[model samples]
Target: MATINTAVLDTFITLTGIKPLAVDVSPVLRERKAALLSILPHWEGAEQSGIFAENFFPDRSVGHRKKELDDLIAQTGNVTGSTEIKAENQLRGSFMLNCPNGNIRVFFTLSPENPPLIQQLDFSLAK
Candidate 1:
C-alpha cells in the first residue's frame, strides 16, 4: 500500500478548495481572515481570540496585545504571500505590508489539535 493515502490529499484539496494551492497562501489564512472579517472592530470575541489568549497572557498594564494586533492589521492589509513551514506543526506567514517602521512575521504554532494557534507575534523594528 502507499505510505500516503488519498485522504491526506483530499484534505488539502478541501481545506484549500476555494483557491488553488499554487495561489492559496495557506488554509489557516482562511480561518484567520474569516474570523477577523466577522469580528474586526472587535476581534476580542473572535474564535482565534482563544489562541491569542493562550499565547499572550493578558496584563493589567493595559489591554493585551490586541491593540498592537489591531495596529498591525491596519498596516498590513492581507496575506498576499505563501505560508512557510517552520516545522511539522509550525508555520510562518507574512502579510502584504511594507513598513519602514518594522517588518512583521506571524508565527503560527500548533496545539494538540490540528488547527494551530498564533504563537509569537512581534513587530520589533530594532535590528
Candidate 2:
C-alpha cells in the first residue's frame, strides 16, 4: 500500500510538474461571491436600475454606468440563455452572458464595503 501511494504521488507530481496547494475559502470571499450571484439575474435581464440601485457604489456616476449598460444591452440583445460566472474573487469577477448574438464577457470590481458594492463594471465580446 505504501509503495502504491508513493508511486501515485510521484506520477502525479511528474505529470503536473507542480504540487497542488490546499485552497481555503475565506468567509469574506464567500460574502462577496454571494453578493455577486445575487446581482447576476438582474444583469442577465438587463435591469440596469435593478443592478445599480443597491449593488453599485454611491460614488460612481450613475449616468455613465447607465449608458454603459445600455450599450451592452444593445450589443448583446436579449439574453437567450443562461449566464455563467467565469471567474471571481473578493474584489472582482467575470461573467459570460449567453445571448442571441454571442457570448458576452462581463467584468466587474467591488468596493471594500462590508457587503461589497460594485465599484466598476465593463463588458466585452467573448472570443
Highest-lDDT candidate: 2
lDDT tens readout by residue for model 1, 3-102 = 4777787788898876643444566745653443354334456544554435344421124455765576466554233334323222444332233444
Please, what are the lDDT tens digits per residue for candidate 2 over residues 1-127? 9999999999999998995553454454445445545554343433453333364546555456556656766877865554544445546666666777777676777667665555667767778
Tell me the lDDT of candidate 1: 0.46
What TM-score would each prediction reach against the true structure?
A: 0.38, 0.51
Give the clashing residue pairs of candidate 2, or none: none
Q: Report lDDT (CA) for all predictions.
A: 0.46, 0.59
Count the clashes in each prediction: 0, 0
In terms of lDDT, the poorest run of 10 residues in model 1 is 81-90
Model 2 TM-score, 2 decimals: 0.51
